[model samples]
Target: MSEGPLDDLDRRIVHSLQQNARKTSASEIAEQAGVSASTVRNRIQNLEAAGILTGYRPEVNYEAASYQLQTLIVCTAPVPEREVLAKKALEVPGVVAVREIMTGTENVHVEAIGSDGDDLSRIGRDLDEIGLEVVDEDLIRNEYECAFHGFDVKDV
Candidate 1:
Protein backbone atom coordinates (compact mmCIF):
# COMPACT_ATOMS: atom_id res chain seq x y z
CA MET A 1 0.00 0.00 0.00
CA SER A 2 2.99 2.29 0.55
CA GLU A 3 6.43 2.79 -0.97
CA GLY A 4 8.33 2.68 2.31
CA PRO A 5 10.61 5.60 3.16
CA LEU A 6 11.28 6.73 -0.45
CA ASP A 7 12.06 10.44 -0.46
CA ASP A 8 11.19 12.79 -3.35
CA LEU A 9 14.59 12.41 -4.99
CA ASP A 10 14.43 8.62 -4.72
CA ARG A 11 11.05 8.57 -6.40
CA ARG A 12 12.20 10.83 -9.24
CA ILE A 13 15.32 8.76 -9.87
CA VAL A 14 13.18 5.61 -9.95
CA HIS A 15 10.68 7.24 -12.28
CA SER A 16 13.44 8.30 -14.67
CA LEU A 17 14.89 4.80 -14.66
CA GLN A 18 11.48 3.30 -15.26
CA GLN A 19 10.99 5.50 -18.31
CA ASN A 20 14.19 4.41 -19.99
CA ALA A 21 16.80 2.50 -18.07
CA ARG A 22 19.26 1.73 -20.88
CA LYS A 23 19.28 4.89 -22.98
CA THR A 24 18.98 7.39 -20.12
CA SER A 25 22.35 8.42 -18.77
CA ALA A 26 23.16 9.31 -15.15
CA SER A 27 23.42 13.03 -15.99
CA GLU A 28 19.99 12.91 -17.65
CA ILE A 29 18.49 11.21 -14.60
CA ALA A 30 20.22 13.73 -12.35
CA GLU A 31 18.77 16.62 -14.35
CA GLN A 32 15.27 15.14 -14.26
CA ALA A 33 15.45 14.01 -10.65
CA GLY A 34 17.10 17.30 -9.57
CA VAL A 35 20.28 15.71 -8.33
CA SER A 36 23.92 15.55 -9.39
CA ALA A 37 25.32 12.69 -11.50
CA SER A 38 27.28 11.39 -8.51
CA THR A 39 24.11 11.50 -6.46
CA VAL A 40 22.24 9.59 -9.12
CA ARG A 41 24.93 6.91 -9.21
CA ASN A 42 24.98 6.60 -5.43
CA ARG A 43 21.21 6.43 -5.15
CA ILE A 44 21.00 3.82 -7.91
CA GLN A 45 23.52 1.63 -6.10
CA ASN A 46 21.54 2.01 -2.90
CA LEU A 47 18.29 1.22 -4.70
CA GLU A 48 19.79 -1.93 -6.19
CA ALA A 49 21.13 -3.00 -2.82
CA ALA A 50 17.73 -2.34 -1.26
CA GLY A 51 16.06 -4.53 -3.91
CA ILE A 52 13.75 -1.78 -5.15
CA LEU A 53 15.62 -1.93 -8.47
CA THR A 54 16.31 -5.51 -9.36
CA GLY A 55 17.08 -5.78 -13.10
CA TYR A 56 16.19 -4.36 -16.49
CA ARG A 57 15.25 -6.12 -19.69
CA PRO A 58 13.67 -5.09 -22.96
CA GLU A 59 10.00 -5.81 -23.67
CA VAL A 60 9.46 -8.24 -26.54
CA ASN A 61 6.49 -8.03 -28.90
CA TYR A 62 5.39 -11.58 -29.58
CA GLU A 63 3.14 -10.78 -32.54
CA ALA A 64 5.74 -8.69 -34.30
CA ALA A 65 8.03 -11.64 -34.01
CA SER A 66 7.27 -15.15 -35.29
CA TYR A 67 5.18 -15.99 -32.24
CA GLN A 68 1.84 -14.77 -33.61
CA LEU A 69 -0.54 -15.98 -30.91
CA GLN A 70 -0.33 -14.66 -27.37
CA THR A 71 -2.53 -15.95 -24.57
CA LEU A 72 -3.28 -15.71 -20.89
CA ILE A 73 -4.23 -18.99 -19.25
CA VAL A 74 -5.90 -18.85 -15.87
CA CYS A 75 -5.31 -21.96 -13.81
CA THR A 76 -6.45 -23.01 -10.35
CA ALA A 77 -4.32 -24.99 -7.96
CA PRO A 78 -3.38 -24.99 -4.28
CA VAL A 79 -0.57 -22.57 -3.35
CA PRO A 80 1.86 -25.42 -2.83
CA GLU A 81 1.00 -27.00 -6.14
CA ARG A 82 0.87 -23.63 -7.89
CA GLU A 83 4.61 -23.02 -7.70
CA VAL A 84 5.55 -26.40 -9.14
CA LEU A 85 2.96 -26.00 -11.85
CA ALA A 86 4.32 -22.56 -12.67
CA LYS A 87 7.85 -23.89 -13.06
CA LYS A 88 6.62 -26.78 -15.16
CA ALA A 89 4.62 -24.43 -17.33
CA LEU A 90 7.89 -22.88 -18.48
CA GLU A 91 8.86 -26.20 -20.04
CA VAL A 92 5.74 -26.18 -22.19
CA PRO A 93 6.40 -24.92 -25.71
CA GLY A 94 5.54 -21.26 -26.29
CA VAL A 95 4.94 -20.49 -22.61
CA VAL A 96 6.87 -17.41 -21.58
CA ALA A 97 6.03 -16.53 -18.00
CA VAL A 98 3.87 -18.01 -15.29
CA ARG A 99 2.75 -15.77 -12.45
CA GLU A 100 1.19 -16.92 -9.20
CA ILE A 101 -1.65 -14.54 -8.40
CA MET A 102 -2.63 -14.41 -4.73
CA THR A 103 -6.26 -13.55 -5.45
CA GLY A 104 -8.28 -14.65 -8.48
CA THR A 105 -10.56 -17.40 -9.83
CA GLU A 106 -7.24 -19.00 -10.63
CA ASN A 107 -4.02 -18.67 -8.69
CA VAL A 108 -1.71 -19.15 -11.72
CA HIS A 109 -1.65 -16.90 -14.77
CA VAL A 110 0.42 -18.25 -17.62
CA GLU A 111 1.57 -15.88 -20.34
CA ALA A 112 2.20 -17.87 -23.47
CA ILE A 113 3.04 -17.45 -27.16
CA GLY A 114 2.14 -19.75 -30.03
CA SER A 115 2.55 -19.89 -33.78
CA ASP A 116 -0.97 -21.14 -34.52
CA GLY A 117 -4.02 -23.03 -33.29
CA ASP A 118 -2.16 -26.33 -32.98
CA ASP A 119 0.48 -24.72 -30.79
CA LEU A 120 -2.21 -23.29 -28.50
CA SER A 121 -3.94 -26.63 -28.24
CA ARG A 122 -0.63 -28.30 -27.38
CA ILE A 123 -0.21 -25.88 -24.49
CA GLY A 124 -3.59 -26.82 -23.05
CA ARG A 125 -2.81 -30.50 -23.41
CA ASP A 126 0.60 -29.95 -21.81
CA LEU A 127 -1.04 -28.35 -18.80
CA ASP A 128 -3.58 -31.13 -18.56
CA GLU A 129 -0.81 -33.71 -18.64
CA ILE A 130 0.83 -31.94 -15.71
CA GLY A 131 -2.48 -32.02 -13.79
CA LEU A 132 -2.89 -28.25 -14.02
CA GLU A 133 -6.38 -27.39 -15.17
CA VAL A 134 -6.93 -24.20 -17.08
CA VAL A 135 -10.10 -22.55 -15.80
CA ASP A 136 -10.09 -19.99 -18.62
CA GLU A 137 -8.10 -18.81 -21.60
CA ASP A 138 -8.02 -15.48 -23.37
CA LEU A 139 -6.21 -14.54 -26.57
CA ILE A 140 -4.49 -11.19 -26.40
CA ARG A 141 -5.72 -8.93 -29.21
CA ASN A 142 -3.45 -5.94 -28.82
CA GLU A 143 -1.30 -4.39 -26.15
CA TYR A 144 -1.01 -0.70 -25.27
CA GLU A 145 2.03 -1.25 -23.12
CA CYS A 146 4.06 0.96 -20.79
CA ALA A 147 6.43 0.41 -17.94
CA PHE A 148 4.98 1.52 -14.56
CA HIS A 149 7.94 0.12 -12.63
CA GLY A 150 5.39 -1.45 -10.28
CA PHE A 151 4.57 1.85 -8.53
CA ASP A 152 2.71 5.13 -8.82
CA VAL A 153 5.08 8.11 -8.47
CA LYS A 154 2.64 10.94 -9.19
CA ASP A 155 2.64 12.30 -5.59
CA VAL A 156 6.09 11.08 -4.64
Candidate 2:
Protein backbone atom coordinates (compact mmCIF):
# COMPACT_ATOMS: atom_id res chain seq x y z
CA MET A 1 0.00 0.00 0.00
CA SER A 2 2.05 2.96 -1.23
CA GLU A 3 0.65 6.11 0.33
CA GLY A 4 1.12 9.83 0.03
CA PRO A 5 -2.12 10.74 -1.62
CA LEU A 6 -4.23 8.82 -4.09
CA ASP A 7 -2.52 8.65 -7.50
CA ASP A 8 -4.33 8.63 -10.84
CA LEU A 9 -4.74 4.87 -10.82
CA ASP A 10 -6.23 4.98 -7.32
CA ARG A 11 -8.72 7.64 -8.32
CA ARG A 12 -9.73 5.67 -11.40
CA ILE A 13 -10.27 2.54 -9.30
CA VAL A 14 -12.42 4.41 -6.78
CA HIS A 15 -14.48 6.01 -9.53
CA SER A 16 -15.13 2.64 -11.14
CA LEU A 17 -16.16 1.03 -7.83
CA GLN A 18 -18.44 3.95 -7.04
CA GLN A 19 -20.21 3.39 -10.34
CA ASN A 20 -21.06 -0.25 -9.63
CA ALA A 21 -19.10 -2.17 -6.99
CA ARG A 22 -21.45 -5.15 -7.17
CA LYS A 23 -21.09 -5.72 -10.90
CA THR A 24 -17.60 -4.41 -11.73
CA SER A 25 -14.70 -6.83 -11.37
CA ALA A 26 -11.06 -6.19 -10.56
CA SER A 27 -10.05 -7.50 -13.98
CA GLU A 28 -12.46 -5.09 -15.65
CA ILE A 29 -11.25 -2.11 -13.64
CA ALA A 30 -7.65 -3.15 -14.21
CA GLU A 31 -8.25 -3.42 -17.94
CA GLN A 32 -9.77 0.07 -17.96
CA ALA A 33 -6.89 1.47 -15.90
CA GLY A 34 -4.29 -0.53 -17.90
CA VAL A 35 -3.11 -2.35 -14.78
CA SER A 36 -3.10 -5.97 -13.59
CA ALA A 37 -6.06 -7.59 -11.77
CA SER A 38 -3.97 -8.15 -8.62
CA THR A 39 -3.02 -4.48 -8.57
CA VAL A 40 -6.64 -3.46 -8.62
CA ARG A 41 -7.49 -5.94 -5.85
CA ASN A 42 -4.61 -4.73 -3.66
CA ARG A 43 -5.63 -1.11 -4.22
CA ILE A 44 -9.18 -1.90 -3.12
CA GLN A 45 -7.85 -3.58 0.07
CA ASN A 46 -5.64 -0.61 0.84
CA LEU A 47 -8.50 1.79 0.21
CA GLU A 48 -10.64 -0.12 2.68
CA ALA A 49 -7.84 -0.28 5.24
CA ALA A 50 -7.38 3.50 4.97
CA GLY A 51 -11.16 3.97 5.47
CA ILE A 52 -11.50 5.54 2.03
CA LEU A 53 -13.65 2.73 0.69
CA THR A 54 -16.54 1.91 3.00
CA GLY A 55 -19.10 -0.87 2.81
CA TYR A 56 -20.93 -1.65 -0.40
CA ARG A 57 -24.68 -1.41 0.11
CA PRO A 58 -27.43 -2.28 -2.30
CA GLU A 59 -29.83 0.38 -3.52
CA VAL A 60 -33.16 -0.87 -2.23
CA ASN A 61 -36.54 0.14 -3.59
CA TYR A 62 -38.51 0.38 -0.35
CA GLU A 63 -41.79 1.24 -2.06
CA ALA A 64 -41.53 -1.74 -4.37
CA ALA A 65 -40.64 -3.90 -1.36
CA SER A 66 -44.10 -3.19 0.13
CA TYR A 67 -42.96 -0.38 2.40
CA GLN A 68 -45.14 2.24 0.75
CA LEU A 69 -44.14 5.33 2.68
CA GLN A 70 -40.66 6.77 2.76
CA THR A 71 -40.34 9.78 5.03
CA LEU A 72 -37.56 12.20 5.82
CA ILE A 73 -37.92 13.42 9.38
CA VAL A 74 -36.19 16.66 10.16
CA CYS A 75 -35.48 17.24 13.82
CA THR A 76 -33.45 19.39 16.20
CA ALA A 77 -31.22 18.35 19.06
CA PRO A 78 -28.73 20.19 21.22
CA VAL A 79 -25.44 20.42 19.38
CA PRO A 80 -23.60 18.74 22.22
CA GLU A 81 -26.02 15.82 22.23
CA ARG A 82 -26.73 15.58 18.50
CA GLU A 83 -24.43 12.67 17.72
CA VAL A 84 -25.70 10.55 20.57
CA LEU A 85 -29.30 11.31 19.63
CA ALA A 86 -28.64 10.39 16.02
CA LYS A 87 -27.42 6.92 17.00
CA LYS A 88 -30.38 6.44 19.27
CA ALA A 89 -32.72 7.37 16.44
CA LEU A 90 -31.42 4.41 14.47
CA GLU A 91 -32.62 2.03 17.17
CA VAL A 92 -36.18 3.18 16.62
CA PRO A 93 -38.18 0.86 14.39
CA GLY A 94 -38.60 2.04 10.78
CA VAL A 95 -35.69 4.47 11.11
CA VAL A 96 -33.18 3.59 8.39
CA ALA A 97 -30.66 6.42 8.31
CA VAL A 98 -29.75 9.55 10.29
CA ARG A 99 -27.60 12.57 9.54
CA GLU A 100 -26.39 15.12 12.07
CA ILE A 101 -26.20 18.56 10.48
CA MET A 102 -23.95 21.42 11.66
CA THR A 103 -26.67 23.97 12.19
CA GLY A 104 -28.50 24.60 15.45
CA THR A 105 -32.06 24.33 14.19
CA GLU A 106 -33.11 21.23 12.29
CA ASN A 107 -29.75 19.65 12.91
CA VAL A 108 -30.79 16.02 12.63
CA HIS A 109 -32.28 14.40 9.54
CA VAL A 110 -33.73 10.88 9.73
CA GLU A 111 -34.86 8.68 6.87
CA ALA A 112 -37.54 6.15 7.76
CA ILE A 113 -39.67 3.72 5.83
CA GLY A 114 -43.09 2.62 6.92
CA SER A 115 -46.28 1.01 5.73
CA ASP A 116 -48.49 4.03 6.45
CA GLY A 117 -49.00 7.23 8.43
CA ASP A 118 -49.36 5.33 11.71
CA ASP A 119 -45.85 3.92 11.35
CA LEU A 120 -44.41 7.39 10.77
CA SER A 121 -46.26 8.73 13.81
CA ARG A 122 -44.79 5.95 15.91
CA ILE A 123 -41.30 6.77 14.72
CA GLY A 124 -41.85 10.48 15.42
CA ARG A 125 -42.97 9.73 18.97
CA ASP A 126 -39.99 7.49 19.52
CA LEU A 127 -37.63 10.23 18.35
CA ASP A 128 -39.30 12.66 20.68
CA GLU A 129 -38.92 10.28 23.57
CA ILE A 130 -35.19 10.14 22.85
CA GLY A 131 -34.99 13.97 23.24
CA LEU A 132 -35.21 14.99 19.58
CA GLU A 133 -37.71 17.68 18.70
CA VAL A 134 -39.37 16.81 15.42
CA VAL A 135 -39.45 20.02 13.38
CA ASP A 136 -40.73 18.86 10.00
CA GLU A 137 -41.12 15.82 7.76
CA ASP A 138 -41.81 15.08 4.13
CA LEU A 139 -42.50 12.10 1.91
CA ILE A 140 -39.42 11.15 -0.09
CA ARG A 141 -40.47 10.40 -3.66
CA ASN A 142 -37.16 9.66 -5.34
CA GLU A 143 -33.40 9.59 -4.93
CA TYR A 144 -30.39 9.47 -7.24
CA GLU A 145 -26.62 9.05 -7.08
CA CYS A 146 -23.61 9.24 -9.40
CA ALA A 147 -19.90 8.57 -9.24
CA PHE A 148 -17.64 11.55 -8.50
CA HIS A 149 -16.39 12.99 -11.78
CA GLY A 150 -13.15 14.22 -10.24
CA PHE A 151 -12.00 10.59 -10.02
CA ASP A 152 -12.99 9.76 -13.59
CA VAL A 153 -10.34 9.05 -16.24
CA LYS A 154 -10.58 11.56 -19.08
CA ASP A 155 -10.66 8.94 -21.87
CA VAL A 156 -12.16 5.89 -20.09
Candidate 3:
Protein backbone atom coordinates (compact mmCIF):
# COMPACT_ATOMS: atom_id res chain seq x y z
CA MET A 1 0.00 0.00 0.00
CA SER A 2 1.12 3.58 -0.61
CA GLU A 3 2.25 5.73 2.31
CA GLY A 4 -0.68 8.05 1.88
CA PRO A 5 -3.54 9.17 4.11
CA LEU A 6 -4.99 6.37 6.18
CA ASP A 7 -8.13 4.84 4.73
CA ASP A 8 -11.03 3.64 6.85
CA LEU A 9 -9.54 0.25 7.63
CA ASP A 10 -6.13 1.71 8.38
CA ARG A 11 -7.64 4.32 10.67
CA ARG A 12 -9.65 1.64 12.45
CA ILE A 13 -6.51 -0.37 13.02
CA VAL A 14 -4.68 2.61 14.42
CA HIS A 15 -7.61 3.54 16.61
CA SER A 16 -7.89 0.03 18.00
CA LEU A 17 -4.18 -0.09 18.79
CA GLN A 18 -4.43 3.29 20.42
CA GLN A 19 -7.16 1.98 22.69
CA ASN A 20 -5.01 -0.83 24.09
CA ALA A 21 -1.94 -1.68 22.10
CA ARG A 22 -0.28 -3.78 24.82
CA LYS A 23 -3.15 -6.01 25.85
CA THR A 24 -5.03 -5.99 22.55
CA SER A 25 -3.95 -8.33 19.80
CA ALA A 26 -4.14 -7.67 16.08
CA SER A 27 -6.79 -10.37 15.77
CA GLU A 28 -8.79 -8.87 18.60
CA ILE A 29 -8.71 -5.39 17.12
CA ALA A 30 -9.69 -6.84 13.81
CA GLU A 31 -12.76 -8.42 15.35
CA GLN A 32 -13.77 -5.23 17.12
CA ALA A 33 -12.92 -2.88 14.27
CA GLY A 34 -14.58 -5.17 11.74
CA VAL A 35 -11.54 -6.14 9.68
CA SER A 36 -9.52 -9.31 9.12
CA ALA A 37 -6.71 -10.07 11.56
CA SER A 38 -4.12 -10.20 8.80
CA THR A 39 -5.32 -6.88 7.49
CA VAL A 40 -5.02 -5.36 10.94
CA ARG A 41 -1.50 -6.68 11.40
CA ASN A 42 -0.33 -5.56 7.99
CA ARG A 43 -1.87 -2.11 8.34
CA ILE A 44 -0.32 -1.62 11.78
CA GLN A 45 3.11 -2.56 10.42
CA ASN A 46 2.67 -0.13 7.58
CA LEU A 47 1.63 2.67 9.92
CA GLU A 48 4.62 2.02 12.14
CA ALA A 49 6.96 2.00 9.17
CA ALA A 50 5.41 5.29 8.00
CA GLY A 51 6.08 6.80 11.44
CA ILE A 52 2.38 7.34 12.06
CA LEU A 53 2.30 4.55 14.60
CA THR A 54 5.27 5.22 16.84
CA GLY A 55 6.62 2.99 19.56
CA TYR A 56 4.48 1.94 22.47
CA ARG A 57 5.16 3.13 26.01
CA PRO A 58 3.71 2.33 29.39
CA GLU A 59 2.01 5.16 31.21
CA VAL A 60 3.74 5.17 34.56
CA ASN A 61 2.54 6.89 37.71
CA TYR A 62 5.22 9.54 38.25
CA GLU A 63 4.00 10.26 41.81
CA ALA A 64 4.80 6.72 42.91
CA ALA A 65 8.29 7.15 41.53
CA SER A 66 8.93 10.12 43.89
CA TYR A 67 7.94 12.68 41.30
CA GLN A 68 5.29 14.24 43.53
CA LEU A 69 4.98 17.58 41.85
CA GLN A 70 3.41 17.95 38.42
CA THR A 71 2.74 21.15 36.58
CA LEU A 72 1.43 22.56 33.31
CA ILE A 73 3.19 25.61 31.96
CA VAL A 74 1.64 27.56 29.11
CA CYS A 75 3.50 30.29 27.33
CA THR A 76 2.79 32.91 24.68
CA ALA A 77 5.50 33.59 22.12
CA PRO A 78 6.29 33.81 18.44
CA VAL A 79 5.28 30.68 16.53
CA PRO A 80 8.76 30.39 15.01
CA GLU A 81 10.40 30.42 18.44
CA ARG A 82 8.00 27.96 20.09
CA GLU A 83 9.87 24.89 18.93
CA VAL A 84 13.21 26.18 20.19
CA LEU A 85 11.69 27.26 23.47
CA ALA A 86 10.08 23.85 23.83
CA LYS A 87 13.45 22.18 23.26
CA LYS A 88 15.02 24.39 25.89
CA ALA A 89 12.20 23.49 28.28
CA LEU A 90 13.28 19.86 27.97
CA GLU A 91 16.69 20.85 29.42
CA VAL A 92 14.85 22.14 32.47
CA PRO A 93 15.36 19.87 35.47
CA GLY A 94 12.03 18.03 35.47
CA VAL A 95 10.31 18.68 32.18
CA VAL A 96 8.93 15.57 30.54
CA ALA A 97 7.12 16.75 27.43
CA VAL A 98 6.90 20.01 25.58
CA ARG A 99 3.84 20.41 23.34
CA GLU A 100 3.19 23.12 20.85
CA ILE A 101 -0.47 24.09 21.19
CA MET A 102 -2.81 26.45 19.44
CA THR A 103 -4.75 28.70 21.73
CA GLY A 104 -5.90 32.26 21.77
CA THR A 105 -3.22 33.17 24.30
CA GLU A 106 -0.48 30.57 24.14
CA ASN A 107 1.54 28.68 21.61
CA VAL A 108 3.64 26.37 23.76
CA HIS A 109 2.70 24.03 26.61
CA VAL A 110 5.04 22.12 28.88
CA GLU A 111 4.59 19.27 31.30
CA ALA A 112 7.06 19.15 34.16
CA ILE A 113 7.55 16.55 36.81
CA GLY A 114 9.31 17.39 40.06
CA SER A 115 10.44 15.55 43.16
CA ASP A 116 8.83 18.00 45.55
CA GLY A 117 7.71 21.56 46.06
CA ASP A 118 11.27 22.88 46.03
CA ASP A 119 11.99 20.95 42.85
CA LEU A 120 8.86 22.36 41.25
CA SER A 121 9.92 25.88 42.17
CA ARG A 122 13.28 25.38 40.51
CA ILE A 123 11.64 23.96 37.43
CA GLY A 124 9.40 26.98 37.20
CA ARG A 125 12.40 29.26 37.37
CA ASP A 126 14.33 27.28 34.80
CA LEU A 127 11.34 27.41 32.47
CA ASP A 128 10.98 31.14 33.07
CA GLU A 129 14.53 31.71 31.87
CA ILE A 130 13.41 30.52 28.44
CA GLY A 131 12.04 34.07 27.95
CA LEU A 132 8.40 33.44 26.93
CA GLU A 133 5.72 35.08 29.00
CA VAL A 134 4.31 32.51 31.37
CA VAL A 135 0.64 32.99 30.67
CA ASP A 136 -0.36 30.41 33.20
CA GLU A 137 1.20 27.90 35.57
CA ASP A 138 -1.19 25.21 36.74
CA LEU A 139 -0.12 22.87 39.52
CA ILE A 140 -1.34 19.42 38.70
CA ARG A 141 -2.82 17.75 41.75
CA ASN A 142 -3.93 14.47 40.23
CA GLU A 143 -4.14 13.27 36.70
CA TYR A 144 -7.79 12.48 36.11
CA GLU A 145 -7.07 10.87 32.77
CA CYS A 146 -4.37 10.40 30.18
CA ALA A 147 -4.49 9.28 26.57
CA PHE A 148 -2.22 8.99 23.57
CA HIS A 149 -3.65 9.41 20.08
CA GLY A 150 -7.41 9.34 20.50
CA PHE A 151 -9.32 9.55 17.23
CA ASP A 152 -12.82 8.56 16.22
CA VAL A 153 -13.04 5.57 13.91
CA LYS A 154 -16.06 7.20 12.33
CA ASP A 155 -13.89 10.13 11.33
CA VAL A 156 -11.71 7.82 9.30
19-119 per-residue lDDT for model 3 (tens digits): 77788898887887787889888888898899998898887788889887788988776777777887888888788888887656588888888787788
lDDT of 1 by residue, 78-123 (tens): 7778888888889998888899888865898888899998999999
Candidate 2 Cα deviation (angstroms), residue 88: 1.0
Q: Candidate 2: worst 10 consecutive residues by lDDT?
A: 1-10
Residue 101 local lDDT, model 1: 86
Q: TM-scores, in order shown?
A: 0.84, 0.94, 0.78
Candidate 1 lands at a TM-score of 0.84
Residue-level lDDT tens digits of model 2 in 1-156: 324578888888899889999999999999988889999999999999999998999999999999999999999999999999999999999999999999669999999999999999999999999999999999999999999987887553
Model 2 residue runs over 4 Å out of place are 1-4
Candidate 1: stretches off by over 4 Å: 1-3, 147-156
Q: Please identify model 3 stretches exceeding 4 Å from their true place.
A: 1-4, 33-36, 144-156
- lDDT of all the models against the reference? 0.83, 0.93, 0.77
Most TM-score-accurate candidate: 2
- Most lDDT-accurate candidate: 2
